[model samples]
Target: MSRLTAAEQKALAERVLDIESRAVSALAGRLDDSFAKACQLCLDLTGRVVVTGMGKSGHIARKIAATLASTGTPAFYMHPAEASHGDLGMITGQDLMLAVSNSGETQEVITILPLVKRMGAKLISMTGKPKSTLAKAADVHFDVSVEEEACPLNLAPTASTTATLAMGDALAVALLESRGFTAEDFALSHPSGSLGKRLLLRVADVMHSGEAIPMVTADVSLSAGLVEMSQKGLGMTAVVDQQQHILGIFTDGDLRRTLDSGVDVHKVPMAEVMHRNCKTIPVDILAAEAIHVMEEHKINGLLVINEDGVLVGALNIHDLFRAGIV
Candidate 1:
C-alpha cells in the first residue's frame, strides 16, 4: 500500500468537491419548461412515482425515491433487473415513471420502456446524453449531463450522480412546496424519528398529570413540599391555591437558597419560599417548545396550566429526554 502526503490528500479531496459542487450548480441553469413539466407530471399522477435505473444510477434512484417518499410524495424504487423479470407489474396507468441512466442506454431500463408505455404510464428520463435512446423515448427529459466526472479517469459516476441527486431533491422540494406541505405533515410521515417527536409530541402527551404531578397547597410547610417533590421525583413541586390555581413553585434551588438564609423548613410556608413568578406553559404546545422555555429560563421543570390558569400537569427536562424531544 502507498500513502499520500497530507497536502496531496487535501488537494485531491478539494478538487473532487470543486467538480461535484460545480456540477450541482450547473443544474440550476438547466431547469426550464422540462423541469416544470416533470414536476407537474408527478403532481398530477394519482399513483406513486416509480423510479428505476441500472448500476450506479440505481443506487441514486433508491435515495431519490426515499427522499420523495419522506417529503410528501408517494414514491418507490423498482430495480430495472427485477422489473424485467416480474416487478414490472408494479407499474400502473396512474403512475409516473422516472428512468435514470447517465448514458441513457442501459439495456435493463430500456427493455421495460415499451411495457411501461403500453400500460399508459407517463415517462420521464434523466440522462447525461440528451440524444440517447432512453431520453428520446421519454415524454419529458432532464439532462443530468456533467462537464467531467470527479474521478481522475472520468469513468466512475461522480459529478453526474451528484447532479442527479441534487436534481431529485429539487423536484421533491418543489413538489413539497406546491402541495403546501408543512413540517407537521412531514413529522406525521416520520412518527418514529426525532423530528416527529419534536413537531408532533405535545407537552400534555409526556407530562405527568393527575396524581403523578408533584404539588402542594400554598399553605403547606416547606417540609411537606419537599416530601411531594421527593415522591414525584421531579426536583420541584408546584404551590397551588385551594382551587388548584398555581401561586408559586418550590424547587431544589429554592431549598438551597433557604438553607443559605438559615430559614427553618418546618416552620416556613411553601408560598413564602417558593418562586412567585414561575414559568408556566399550556399542555397543547409542542414539547420541543417547552424545552426552549426551560433552556431560556435556565430552569429544569415547568408547571402546566390549562386555559383557565389552573394547574393540570407538570414536566421536567427528564420528561423531554424520555419523549425524545431533547
Candidate 2:
C-alpha cells in the first residue's frame, strides 16, 4: 500500500471539509420564499408531521424528524416501503408528509404518492432535481442539490447527504422560531433529562413536606432544637410563631458560631442567635431557582412558605441532589 505524505493527507481532509461545508452554506442562497412557505406549513400543522424518504435520504429524514420532535415540532418518521405494508394507516388527512429522494424518483416512495394524495395529506418533498416528478407533485419542494459529491467518484452520497441534513436543520429551526418554542417546552419532551430537572422540577416536587418537615418553636431550648435538627437531618430547623408563621431559622452553622462566641446555648434565648431574615422560597418556584437563592444567600437549606407566609416545610441541598434536580 502507498503511504500518503503529511501534505497529501492534509490537502485531502481540507478538500473534503471544504466541499461538504460549501454544500451546506450554498443552501443559504436557495433559502428564499419556498423555505418560508415550508416553515409556515409545518407550523400550521394541526397533526403530526409524517417524514418519509428513500435510501440515504431516508436516513437523513429519520434524523431530521427526530430533531423536529425534540425541538417541540410534532413529527415522526415513516418508511415509504412500509407504508405499502399498512404503515400508511399511521398517517391521517390532517398530517403533513415530508418526502425525501435525491433522484426525485424512488419506486417505493413514488408508489405511495397517490395514497398520500388520496388521503388528502399535505405533501412536502426534498429532492436534488427540481424538475423531478416528486418535486412536481409536492406542495413545497426544498432543493438539496449540490454541485458535486465529496466522493472522488462523484457517485456515492456525500455532499448531497450533507446538504440534505443541513436543509432539514433549516426547516426545523425555522418552524421552531414560528412556534415560539421555549426551553420549558423542549424540557417537557425530555422529562428524564438534566434539562428537564433544571426547567420542570419545582421546589415543591422534591421538598420535604407534611410530617417530614423539621420545625422547632422559638421558646424551644437550643439542645432540643439540636435534637430536632439531628432527627430531621436537614442541617436546619424553622423557628415558627404561634400562628405557624416563620420567625427565623436556626442552623448547625449558627450553633457553631454561637459556641465559638462563648454564648450560653442552654440559657440564652435561641431567637437572639438565629438568622431572622433567613432565605425562604415558595413551593411553586423551580428547583433551579431555589439553587440560585441558596447560592446567593450562602445557605444550604431554605424555609418553604405559602402565600400566607406560614412555614409549610423544610428541605436541604441533599434532598435536591437525591431527587436529581440539582
Candidate 3:
C-alpha cells in the first residue's frame, strides 16, 4: 500500500469519478435496437428474469435484479457459480436470463450458457467484448464497453462496472415506464417503507370510527360536547344530526372562544358554539392527504365523512403520528 499527500488523494479520487462518469455517459449512445429488444424480451417474459454474473459483476447483477423486481419486472439474482452446481434448475423455459460479464467470457456464467439455451430461456448479455462467445450466444447483447478503467493501472473493474450498473438502471427505468408502473405499485413492493405508508395507508385505516368517535347532537349542550370530547380523548366532538350527518365540529379552540364570549357551557347548544364549514375528508383518502388538508387549513384534526356526508370517523395529528403517517 502507498500513502499519498491530501492533495494527491483528492486528485486521484476526482480522476476516478471523472472516468466512471464518462463511462456511464458513453452508455447512452450504446442504447439502440438491442437495448429495446432486451427490454421487450423482459416485458414479454411470462416468468422471472434470472440475472447471473460472477465476482464483482455478481454484486451489480444482484442490484439490477432488485431494481427490476421493485420496478414491476419480476426478477431475481442467480449466482453463475451456483447455477453450475444445480441452481440452474431455478431457470425455466418461461424465464429470461440477463448475464453480466465485462470481458464477455466469465467462465462461471459461460458454463451455464448451454443449459440456459437448452431450457429455451431468452438470454440478454452485457459485455465489453462484443465478439466474445457469451455475446455471440446471447439473444440480445448490450455493449457496456468502456475506453479504460478508472484504476490507474487499468487492471481492475472500475469504469466497466460503473457502466454496467448504469445500463442496468437504464433498463429498469425504461421498463418501469413502459409497464406504466406507478408510485403506488412501487409502494406495494415496499410496504414496510415510508413511501408505502404514505401511499397505501387510508384514513379509514387510522381514523377513530364507530363507538370510538366523539359525537354530540346539534342541540346538545356545549358541556355535553366537552364531556364527549373528554371521554373519547380526541380534544373535539362532531355536532351531528340524528342520522349522524355532520353539522359542525366543536374543538378545544371553539370551547375557549365560547368561554371568552361569556357563553354558559351548560346552556349553549353545540350548533351555536361549533365551527361550521370545517375541513372534512373522505374515509377512502390516503392518510398523507389528511396531513395535507390539516396543514392547508392550519388545523390539527379532521372529520372523516362517507359518500353520503355522514360522519364516519375522526382523526387528529396525534393519530397520524401514531400510525406513522405524519
In the order shown, the candidates' Cα RMSDs to the true structure are 2.6, 2.6, 2.6
Residue 56 lDDT in model 1? 93
Q: How many angstroms is residue 124 displaced in model 3 relative to the true structure, after the best TM-score fit? A: 0.8
Please provide, for model 2 over 104-213, each residue's C-alpha lDDT reduced to its tens digit, 9 standing for 90 to 100.
99888999999899989899999999999999999999889999998989999999999999999888887887888898898999989999888999888888888788
Indicate the worst ten consecutive residues by lDDT in candidate 2. 263-272
lDDT of 3 by residue, 1-326 (tens): 66998899999999999999999999888778888888899999999999999999999999999999999999999999988888999989999999999999899999999999999999999999999999999999999999999999998999999999999999999999999999999999998788899999999999999999999999889888899999999988999999998888999998888899998889988889889988899999999999999999899989999999999999999999988887
Better of 1 and 3 by lDDT: 1
Tens digit of per-residue lDDT, candidate 1, span 85-179: 89999999999999999999999999999999999999999999999999999999999999999999999999999999999999999999999
Cα-based lDDT for every prediction: 0.94, 0.89, 0.93
Q: In model 3, what are the clashing residue pairs, if there are any? A: none
Q: For each candidate, what TM-score against the reference?
A: 0.88, 0.88, 0.89
Candidate of highest lDDT: 1
Q: Tell me which residue pairs clash in candidate 1.
A: none
The list of candidate 3 runs beyond 4 A from truth reads 218-221, 266-269, 321-326
lDDT, residue 30, model 2: 83
Is candidate 1 or 2 superior in lDDT?
1
Candidate 1 stretches with Cα past 4 Å from truth are 241-243, 275-278, 295-298, 307-310, 321-326
lDDT, model 2, position 70: 94
The local distance difference test score of model 3 is 0.93
- Ranking according to lDDT, highest score first: 1, 3, 2
